[model samples]
Target: MNAPTVPVLQVHQLTKSVQLEDEVLHILESVELTINPSESVAIVGPSGSGKSTLLSLLAGLDQPSSGSIELMGKPFHDLSEDGRAAARAGTVGFVFQNFQLLPALTALENVMLPLELQGARDAEAKARHFMDEVGLGHRLNHQPGRLSGGEQQRVAIARAFATQPALLFADEPTGNLDSANSQKVEDLLFKLNAEFGTTLVLVTHDRELAKRCQRTLVLDNGTLVEAAHASTGA
Candidate 1:
């Protein structure tokens, strides 16, 4: 018999609550889902609909009030803070709308940070390879202030992929780009995923971007629902 596969990410009864003096805000509620390895998924919703909150929880960056999560077959919600950090270090990558590059670091240094942190001896070589992959080899020594928004985001994408994580969490990866740059970044994102078999979980308001994913999860006022199929459902 063939070996069974494990989900790249899994969640059950996930929820987040916050106190606001006399009232409680439920940021997420009873959310449950699973993502297979190498799958690309999008989480879409209006502002304050808990899309980002869900992403944070799924990535184990934020704690949920009640529920469970498993990332890469390891317990997420149940892990201690230090343990969760270790888990993330091993199997997660992230890209943000703001690009989140360190102003003091050059594109090459920015791409090398993660590998260096992991004590890889070949960080520079690996970073250079990814930077070249993202078409930034010519700009490797440029600092964030010297690069355009698109270039900065490309640097960010290069950094995110240097670790080759099992899953990539992208929060509005193209939110800050112009239409042309956005399309370029989008094309690169898909190409990287298909090439690396990295499971992608993106939180985006862009319908076109979401449509490119293999699956879409819609969040509405803290509830989770899978988007309807185009041809199989009305």
Candidate 2:
């Protein structure tokens, strides 16, 4: 008999709202979710459906108005902004829609930044390994300004995985790419994710990409629901 796996993320009664003049705008309401270790999950929804908001909250980038969020067994919703930052350090990785590379840094430097911040003595070596993993090893000397969008994004992916984070969150990772680049990045994303055995939670509008994950969660009416399968209609 095997022991039950501990969840990487747990949420309950999650809600977020803001005051708009005299009206209170509700972005999320009583959402419940759980993700086990090494699970690949995708959250998909239309624009303004709070998909990004939920991702932010889950990643500890923002706090919800009310709820409990346990990230990696820590009380994420209870932590202050700085506390959240400290908790995420070295434990979490992120990939944003816009490649958030420093313009002054070369591709290798960008990948090495996080490792250097964590005081990893062999930062350059680790960065090089991941850059090669993403097939961007040849572009290591190029700066973000010189690299193509696809190459820059591959650098971002390598940077995200360099620290070997236990969990990763990506928001619209392929949104800015063309169909061809999107496919390539998608393939690389899943390939490295599996190799590293990192738990993945991504927010994207691409249904095809979502289907590649183990589960697809749909954000509807300010809450989450499991996406129905079209093949079996289950």
lDDT of 2 by residue, 54-120 (tens): 9999998889999999988778898989999999998899999999999999999999999999999
TM-score of each: 0.96, 0.96
Q: List candidate 1 segments past 4 Å from native.
A: 229-234
lDDT of 1 by residue, 94-194 (tens): 99999999999999999999999999999999999999999999999999999999999999999999999999999999999999999889989988998
lDDT assessment of candidate 2: 0.91
Which pairs of residues collide in model 1?
none
TM-score between model 1 and native:
0.96
For each candidate, what is the lDDT? 0.91, 0.91
TM-score, prediction 2: 0.96
Report per-prediction Cα RMSD to one decimal.
2.6, 2.4
